[model samples]
Target: MNSDTPQLKSFRSFEARQDGDRQTSRSESYLRTGRESSVISATIQADSTGRDMSIDLDVSADATHLKRFVVSVDFGTTFSSISFLILPRNTPPDSLDPHILYHHIQTIDHFPEEPCLGLAESRKEVPTEIWYPKEEYLEDSIMGDGTGSDDSPEGDMPFHLQNEDEENTYWGYEVYSCQRIDTDPNQNRRMGGFKLLFDESELTAQIRLDLEPTLDMMKKKKIIKDREDVISHYLKHLFSHAKEELSEKHEYTNDCPLGFVLCVPPIWTPKACRIMQTNMVRAIQESGYGSFGNCIDNLFIVSEPEAAAAYVIESTTTVLPKEAFMLLDAGGGTVDAITYTVNQTCPLRLEAEGVEAGGALCGSSYLNKAFQEHLSARLKDEDYLERNGISIRSIVDTEVVKFENNIKRKIDIIRPTSVFEFVEIQDLRADPRKNFGRNRLRLTHNDLRGIFLPVLEKVSGLMERQLELAKMRRINVTKVILIGGFANSPSLRSFLKRKLASIKSYQDEDIPLWARRRFLVPSSEPSTRETGRDASAVQVMDFDVMNRSILMTSLLTGESFPIASLWMAGST
Candidate 1:
């Protein structure tokens, strides 16, 4: 264990927000046996409403006392990330300046079994998918019937065959790597999206419809006993790896005070949060973290929007007071559109507006679904299929790498001539009329747009509604901050910009209010005013920013699993 660990190479000064109406609550039992107890002295300030929204938590401590470590997890629907911070113990209950904290904070850039797939670029996130091997994942099961089978007969799928030598449960990239080649859904248990099932009452009819088949399959295969079981196992994977990463980095023994800041979806009820905590505590205990006394006592649960807020504060250099922005978290499974009004600039305080959080099942998964639907229609000839020996889904699953690079991220309305070519099959004869030629499924701009527009339409509607509500409330929304894996799509941003352009003038145009109009005109050509500020409203986060994520939440299996991008933020 080196005396030093990864230093935050980026950022300077730090700021954090504690907004409430004059509330001073102490953290639970910070005492450790044979160690100095933490005593956090906080300076509280009040706003005009007599609500105490000002609190400074960054109080430097002496180097000798003890070391306090903070870990935040984004357990999401499609992908997830982990970050940690280590501070001196002398400050006790004082707050850790997020900028200074983030400077030292490091995200999990490596994972247990990261495969060598043909991805466009490496991201800090790992796939939220997991698998408990039935016949055990062998080296050679890559080609199969796309239904996620281990290429085994019904008789061989019993749980009894799971541990011939060993049946290791794998997560993240390992799941994708193994599931692509070999995985028997009938025998080996594969689970994801359970994070979304924490509260049955919060499940929309559409979510229920999407989740039912998987849940029924899990039941049929006895993959899960209940919601707790699913979360417990998955979290065990996450925590165990987190501990390992920290250990190798700083010789992170379980001696210091370890606290977790978990991010959850806003739509989750208190009961849902409780359910996730119960399972998470169990995972912590089972993982090496509970080796010491009371490691789970200081678990801090924050909403996804709040965590996203934390990320924003860490990134932006200037924030206008009274500035309002709509943060659209679009990921694999779900999209949540929430408008926040900034109360201050430095120690940023956010207040949710009256429009209410607009959440829906339209996410990147829908695009995948639409793509799969297109394949189902095109790839139907039995003989063609027999020659190919691969299902439509198998191609989609395997070519996910390509889809992400081409169709998912780059599909746009502007490129009518652009074409996206999926995996090639030399045996199947090419049919240009059906958009299949040159041995590949070549999707033109229109084809790709058809795949992206429906989902983007839902996303656009979600944003427009909030903008409308904000208009009604006379709250001007300045920037639209786009985050999440789904937000990684360029087409979505373009689509949203076009939607904003199409919006009719809020009031009858008395010479078209150029500078005063609340919403942005996406395109320069259509705006009745100067084109200089056109497309000024939309803000798409870069990949690095998305990778260096903050305000992250996790959930279990989801419409696709994101809330980080807390994806079903599974373990939020």
Candidate 2:
């Protein structure tokens, strides 16, 4: 992973060739050379096996094509999102303004309707859920178009149905948001929360047993042939939808070569990343957007935290050079933390080599699980359950989870005395009087604190450990930048600010709080005022924006440039 290694030597060779041309700028060099020269190759040496794997990349294609776009996919455990950055052929890479770049990093909000349910919806991120059709409906869906042949032209059928009938599956928010169907056992088995399973080095006997049913369903329906196929299936749909968006909304033609930058957790091993990349490549190939060879050549992988740091450094006006800062990516499935020292400001180099990194599975999804458990305990009355013919699990899943997802972000963590009222559950049962206290569930300050405190504490502990490591290295960490969906939690922000502010080193008694350190969050300002079907949701930092920043970094640093290379090489 070091820059001096043989793998990087190939990268350096490519850079040298690009720099040798005085007549053309580095970005313009691709225009003079043919498609063959646009291709760049890098080798990845496996740590355990010492096998060198060659990765062919077309990093300079953006410079060659008349129109190029970088499609960034932030594939998460609970939700998945996509964004697009159009690199206009006329604009030089170095001359491209940051403000203009932000304008092109548009979030994809609209998603295709489910084939089975025929329901359409628009949202910022699609729920990473899929449903298997029953045998009868499956046949009808597969052969409904009269031809009933798998060889039908892809253009003839619906976008989702372009693939082989057997491989076609239903997905999107409608699949998960729809009411539970009880008619068929396989009618609505939602497949999600399985993204992390791929990262496990080995599956235990019990784990394999638990996953049998889902795996069998996937295989039986011909939706996927194997475990890795699940990712391929999901990504196929995602890439297809993104292509449709670009064509219809952005007026992109097929002549434009598309580049992709996929974001993954920093904690994932090289093998895990390779597995993801392999499946994603298969997905892009099957998506029919372009040839498999061309798509794979343009693909790149980036760390989520590094991408977040890139966005913060470029978008925010407060960050300064040579200052050490920590980036905490509090995502849905995992929390990843990494410290970066700004090495340069002009070209923006944040060196994260040899820095200690920390992470845990205690993400926002766990808080939802905790809330479900809390509700179950409170509603565990046998008599009440029997009379109402209602299950605690159903109430929590349908009612309590919604409240937690929507209201938790709005809660003011500064005011500990405040209480959150939940009257949404009162209508769960027809008999309002039979429910708890006039069909209302009250959550005291203590209850609210209890729900999120444990997870937040774990995150806080991760930050503390990272800070301690920075201190041990004699690196003065001065700022913390929070990103990802879960980082929007007011309670989590308030907790971190309060907890980190009080700590003092044994040697520094007189250091002022502001001078010692600070916490930075992306501004809530909207990036653009473009009117469209799916207007981007305003947040501190949209995951898509971070993704675009990563894409920008890749173009500036070259395809062979590794983010946090030193740390990744040194990490276990």
Q: Whose TM-score is greatest here?
A: 1
> What lDDT score goes with residue 1 in model 2?
42
Model 2 clash tally? 0
* lDDT accuracy of residue 7 in candidate 2: 34
- Cα RMSD of all models vs. native, in order, equals 14.7, 14.7
**Residue 127 error, candidate 2, Å:** 2.2
lDDT of 2 by residue, 81-123 (tens): 7756554433323223342234224545556642231133234
Off by over 4 Å in 1: 1-67, 93-95, 112-121, 135-166, 183-188, 199-203, 209-223, 290-292, 387-392, 502-572
**Cα displacement (Å) at residue 151, model 2:** 23
lDDT of 1 by residue, 320-392 (tens): 6676777777767778888877776444456777777788778777787787676666676525554234555
Pick by lDDT: which candidate is best? 2
